[model samples]
Target: MNLESPKITLEKSATEAFNFLSDVQNFKKLMPENISKFEVLGEDKFLFALKGMPEIILKKKEVTPYSKIVLGAAGGKLDFSLIGNISEIETNQSTVQLTFEGDFNPMMSMMIKGPIGKFIETLVTNMKTAI
Candidate 1:
């Protein structure tokens, strides 16, 4: 399954946003308000738990300066990739996008599509104010 966050314009420059996101720990600040626990395990990894979901550990997979940051589940029931794409719009302004892609069976996809979509939307919405 593939879930995408809406493209958002942010006040920070592309490089600034990239720098912030390159450090996976910063993602804890962008999670939903209902998240029960958040832990920064290391510079490249973090764990978080939502209201009804199991803990998920995210690790930085790759980062391309001022362009993209790719993250993946470190070890969990879910196998997924979260990608952040950044583009410069103007001086001190940037366009940002987030996408979540998971490997799920049909039944699981049906169960998670809506929630995942909403989660992505909430994440991006919060991210707009975060940066």
Candidate 2:
């Protein structure tokens, strides 16, 4: 399954946005207010849990400087990746969009489609201020 977030413009430059997101510690600022738990495991990994979902561990899988960042599930029942794409729009502004890709059976996808979609939307909406 693949889900993409609506593109959002940020007040910061692409480099600034990328730098902020590169650090695991700064991710908390982007999470929803309902985030039940969030913990940085290391420089490249973190663990997080939402109110009604199981804990998920994600690690930085790849980075393309100021262009993109890819995070994948460390080890869990699900195999998925969250990708952040950044593009400079002006001297001190940029646009960001997030994509979520997951390998799940049809049944599982059907079950999670709604919540996961909302989750992505929330993350994107929060980016307007969080970034």
Candidate 3:
């Protein structure tokens, strides 16, 4: 399954937003207020858990300079990736959109799609202030 977030303009430049997101530790600032747990495992990985979800461990998989960042599940029953796409709109401003791709059976996808969509929306909304 694939889900994309609505693009949002950021006050920071593409490079600035990319730099902030490339660091796993900075993700805490962008997580929803209902986050139950959060921890930086290393320079390239982090773990977090929402109120009703199992803890998720994510590792930085790839980065394309200031244009994109891809994070994948480290080791879990679920296999998924989260991608951040950044585009510069002005010298000091940019737009960002997030994509979530998951490998799940149709049944599972149907069961979780709504929550995942909400999760993506919350993350994108937080970026307006967290970036």
The lDDT leader among the candidates is: 3
Instruction: Please write out the lDDT profile of model 3 over residues 7-93, one tens digit for every residue.
Output: 999989999999988999988988888999999999999999999899999999999999999999999899999999999999999
Per-residue lDDT of 13-68 in model 2, one digit per residue for the tens? 99998998899888788887789999999999999998988999989999999989
Candidate 3 achieves a global lDDT of: 0.93
Q: TM per model? A: 0.95, 0.96, 0.97
**What's the lDDT for all of these models?**
0.88, 0.91, 0.93
Name the candidate, 1 or 3, with the larger TM-score value. 3
Q: Write the per-residue lDDT of candidate 1 for residues 4-65, one digit (tens) a residue.
A: 88999999999999998887777877888889999999989999889998888889998889
RMSD of each: 1.0, 0.9, 0.8
Best by TM-score: 3
Of the two candidates 1 and 3, the one with more favorable lDDT, higher being better, is 3
Stretches of candidate 1 exceeding 4 Å from the true structure:
none
Residue 19 C-alpha lDDT in model 1? 90
Off by over 4 Å in 2: none
